[model samples]
Target: MTALGLLYPGHSAEDDYPRIEQLLGSDIRVDVVHTDIGEDAHRVDALKEMGSPERLAAGVEQLRLTGAESVVWACTSGSFVYGWEGAHDQVRALARTAGMPASSTSFAFVHAAAELGVRRVAVGATYPDDVADLFASFLGAGGVEVVSVRGSGVITAAEVGEWTEEDVLTLARQADTPTAEALLLPDTALHTAALIPTLEKELSKPVLTANQVTVWEALRLTDRRVNAPALGALFTREPIVQV
Candidate 1:
């Protein structure tokens, strides 16, 4: 079995892994090491705060020892909130520590969309409106256009995690734009992995969730090119070479 390591904040992996497993089809072993975001609120800000390089690096190091071939920082807000350069630096730093490939959920979203040949995308997030724009800008830098954006304005990882499936589905519907080729629910705190199939069916376009791309990118770094039927159009599309 191919092993992939995911470094995420505290949440229920039992709920998240099934969606990923459905995509990789039981051949991939996903090892998730959750860090405590609730305890160290001082070191990181919610979607808007700069992620601590020291803490992030340490977390990647810990996840690396979990027998993972590659590692991914599975927090979208925590990664891209640092801006493009900062996000790149963080990934490089984590890769250096792990002595393996590393990526962030934020970068994964854009790369996944690009892989699908999507140019315009709508934004759906559980963050405040202003904070959501930070994500938009990050994606825009990667050659994707942001059409419309909607946010729930919620703060704190715990609160975001506690949101129901209905909350995310509603937000995704509201954020859809006519010009959008895809919709991005870009927050690792908000679990949209299981909802990707539903979202794509409703929108009739690819709906790239945070964890979806995070996992996809991490898997791409390995030799495993998984075809996940349950992951929606993002995974259903052909494999794309990273530019």
Candidate 2:
């Protein structure tokens, strides 16, 4: 089995990893280790602290015990709040600490978009508009165009985790645009593991969620792919050929 480690921040939506593991069958294993959350606010300072090297290192120690081949920081706002370059550095540090391939959900969205040949996307963010704007900018750095972004102005991960399936669908509908090739729900705190197929069907397009892309990113690092259509378009594709 290919084991993927997720260094999650706090209590929201970490359960999505296990749901993904079950969906992908026994060939893959997902292990989540919650890192220090410090303050659960979505502000830049709080997020930066959340993804700090010290906290990630601590989480890596736990993942090492799980025999995880790859590690991913499973928080979108926590990584993107560091901006594109800083996020790269963050994962680099994580890789060094884990002694494995490492990435973050922010980069996961970018890579997932490219995997599906989607250049333009609309964002359905649970962060405030200002924080969500940072995500758009980070995507821009990764060569994905943000056609539009709609933020829910939610302040904490706890609140986002409590959002129901209908709430997620509503956000997707609100963020989608005619010009966008796909829609992105960029909040790992939000529960979306069960809503991916529904969201894609309702929008009639690809809907990439934070947790979904996080698992995909871990698999990408391991050069593995699974046939799980229920996980939506990203998982339906074949393994990516890395040059």
Candidate 3:
């Protein structure tokens, strides 16, 4: 079995891993190690602290001991809070510490959008506007253009994690614009695995969610592929080769 390692922050999105593993079928297994985030007044600051090199490295050490083939920093805001270069450097640090290929949910969004040949995308995030803008900038640095971004202004991942399908569908509807070829919900705390097809059907375009892209990115790192129709267009399309 191919073991994909995940280093997540706090309690958010941990359950999504099992859902992803099930979608991947019986061939892949997801092994996860979580890191604690320090308390802070602002959500961005808390995410930054959770994704800080020191904390991430510690989690990487734990996942490395699990004999994982590839590691993913499975926090969207946590990874994107540093901007593009910082998010890149964060993955590099994890790879170095784990001695394996590493990626984060932030990069996953950029790459997943690229896979669908979506140059301009509308982004809906379950974060404060400032934090959402940082994520849009991170995608921009990766050469994907964010046509528009709508943030829910939700303070914490824990709060985002509690959002229902109705909440996500409403935000996604609000985020989609005329020029957008795709829609992005960039937050690992979001549970979008089961709702991807529904969102796409409603929006008449592809909807790339954080956990979906994260799993796809992990599969890409290991050169593995699966046909997950229920996951949406990104999973059904051709595998993306990172340039």
Candidate 4:
């Protein structure tokens, strides 16, 4: 069985990984190790500390026991808050510590968008506008365009986790724009594993949520792909070929 390690920030939606593992069937295993979350605030300083090398290193030690072939920092705000370049450096450090292919949910969204050949996307962010703006900038650096962004201004991961399915759908609808090719829900704290197909159907477009993209990114690093349509458009079609 292939094993993917997820270094999640806190107690929010870490459970989504296991749900993904089940959806992918028994051939894959998703192990989650929660890292130190000093302050759950969505501010830049708190987020940077949340994704610090020291904390990631500690999480990697636990994942090593799981024999995870790849690792992903399963927090979007935590990584994107560091900006594009810094996020790259963060995963590089994680890879070194884990001795495995490593990435973060922020990069996951970027790569997932590229795989689907989606350039313009609308963001349904759970962060404050300032923090949400940083995520848009991070996506910009990856060559993805943000057609629009809707921030909930939620202060903590705990609050985002408390959001219900209807709340998620409402955000997707509000954030979607006619110009956007897809809608992105960029908070790992939010529970979305079961709402991907519903969200995509309701919006009539691709819906890329944090936990969904996080699993997809881990599969990409392992050079493996599983056809799980329930995961939504990201998993329903073949990867777009780049010339």
lDDT for each of the candidates? 0.78, 0.92, 0.85, 0.92
Off by over 4 Å in 4: none
Give the per-residue Cα lDDT of candidate 2 at 231: 96
lDDT of 3 by residue, 1-243 (tens): 888998877776678789878988998988978887666223667778888889988777778877799999888888888888888889998888889999998898888888888889999987888888988888889998999999888877778778898998999999999899999998877878889989999999999998888888888899988898988998798755667
- Candidate 3 accuracy as lDDT: 0.85
Each candidate's TM vs. the true structure? 0.90, 0.97, 0.95, 0.99
Decide which is better by lDDT, 2 or 3. Answer: 2
Candidate 2 TM-score, true structure as reference: 0.97
Candidate 3's displacement at residue 87, Å, is 1.5
**Predicted model with the maximum TM-score:** 4
Better of 2 and 3 by TM-score: 2
Q: lDDT, candidate 4, residue 186?
A: 93
- Ranked by TM-score, top first: 4, 2, 3, 1
Candidate 3 has its poorest 10 consecutive residues by lDDT at 36-45
Clash-forming residue pairs, model 3: none
User: In angstroms, how far off is 174's CA in candidate 3?
Assistant: 0.8
